[model samples]
Target: MPATDLVTAELTLTGRITTASNATFLGSIGDVAVVYKPIAGESPLWDFPRGTLALREVAAYQVSQVFGWNVVPHTWLRDGPFGEGMVQLWQEQDPAQSAVNLVATDHVPEVGWKHVLEGQDESGQMVALIHEDTPALRRMAVFDVVVNNADRKGDHILAMTDGHRHGVDHGLTFHRDHKLRSVLWGWLGDALTVEELEGIDRVSEGLNGGLGRDLAELLSAEEIGSLAVRCDRLRLSERFPAPSGEMSAVPWPLF
Candidate 1:
């Protein structure tokens, strides 16, 4: 079925995703499952504009597509039961595979995984946080930087059964300020791969065309301009950036 039909068709709410900070619901249009976040349900944040969270989620998806990364799932803005909202096709994450994890400090993996940070656990014993070092995840990290993602919790990275990594919960993104808080900091200071640079180039070129046109509908002029600035900076540096703000680099709760 066409994506338009699926998004506009009558939706049957199956359940609420209570864990989400903003009100979110699981629904279906015919046989297709989707996650929906209504604009009216968004909680106000000091930094972001009111009622714009749902639009930001859809904007993130558009940026992901512009880069040709497909890091974010298919998402769009539409009217739902609660009013205007963001609707995204639900992706089933792999139950057996965990891409991010906490482990005893002594058992940190020597390869394949990147140890992000070390700290004390509840009992005061040393523990470490680690995440898989893969191209899929690297792409997502790059995507987050371009979008200025503010809440990239570990649980937000969905590891699919086929090994694809999908990033979600991008309601806090594309701010004029640099607000990139994330769990994918394993690539800090690393040189961007050729593929990654190419992706950045694609987005930079589109900022004045299709991508910019789409984003203007959801973001402010300053926000769209800041996004282009981020792409340019990343392209020029050709490396992952280190955190530079007074705010914490990683999100709270981790997952």
Candidate 2:
């Protein structure tokens, strides 16, 4: 479908996604399915700016477009059934596949995967969090760092049948603080690849032009400046940063 149609078509609500922290709905703009989060339905947060999550979501998509990694799905803000909100093209991920998983500590895959951490499950069984050590997932980890994503629980990652990995639910992003929390820590401290460096370069160069102008509409000046700073640090350090400071390294309820 043409992108213009998505913006102009009437959005009809088909169902509700009960698990979302804020109000989220499954709907369609004609035949194209979409996920919608109304700004009015946004819950208050202690740190993030009030009622700005929808903007941040669209901003995340803008950043992803500049990166050319498709880390995030196509996202935009428009008026919906509940008024103004963020609307995104819904992606139907492969049902039988999972990019991240939990397994018994001893049975963790010795190849093609990376172990993140170990803990006891609800039933008291020892288990480990692990994810596929694929290039796609690696790009997502890098994307999370660039966006300062604050909530990267396991379920946020969608595994596509074609082997692509898509990261979703980007409402908590573009903070001017080090708020990154993710399940993609499998590549911590790894050296950045040439292609990865190039992607960062694209974002850096774009910041002074169209990308910068677009973000100015969705994020505060401080938040946009912090994004540039993160890009510079990523380029200079040339490695995945280990979680540090007083902030928790990972999100709670992992999944």
Q: State the C-alpha lDDT per candidate.
A: 0.93, 0.94
lDDT of 1 by residue, 1-255 (tens): 687787679877999999999999999888999998999999999999999999899999999998898899999988888998999999999999988999999999999999889999889999999999999999999999999999999999999999999999999999999999988889899999999999999999898899899999999999999999999999999999999979999999899
Q: Quote model 2's TM-score.
A: 0.99
- TM-scores, all candidates, are 0.98, 0.99
Instruction: Extract clashing residue pairs from model 1.
Output: none
lDDT of 2 by residue, 1-255 (tens): 789989998999999999999999999999999999999999999999899999999999999999999989999999999999999999999999999899999999999999999999999999999999999999899989999999999899999999999999999999998999998899889999998999999999999999999999999999999999999999999999999779888888799
Give the CA lDDT, 0 to 100, for residue 236 in model 2: 98
Clashing pairs in 2: none
Error of 2 at 65 (Å): 0.6
As a TM-score, model 1 comes out at: 0.98
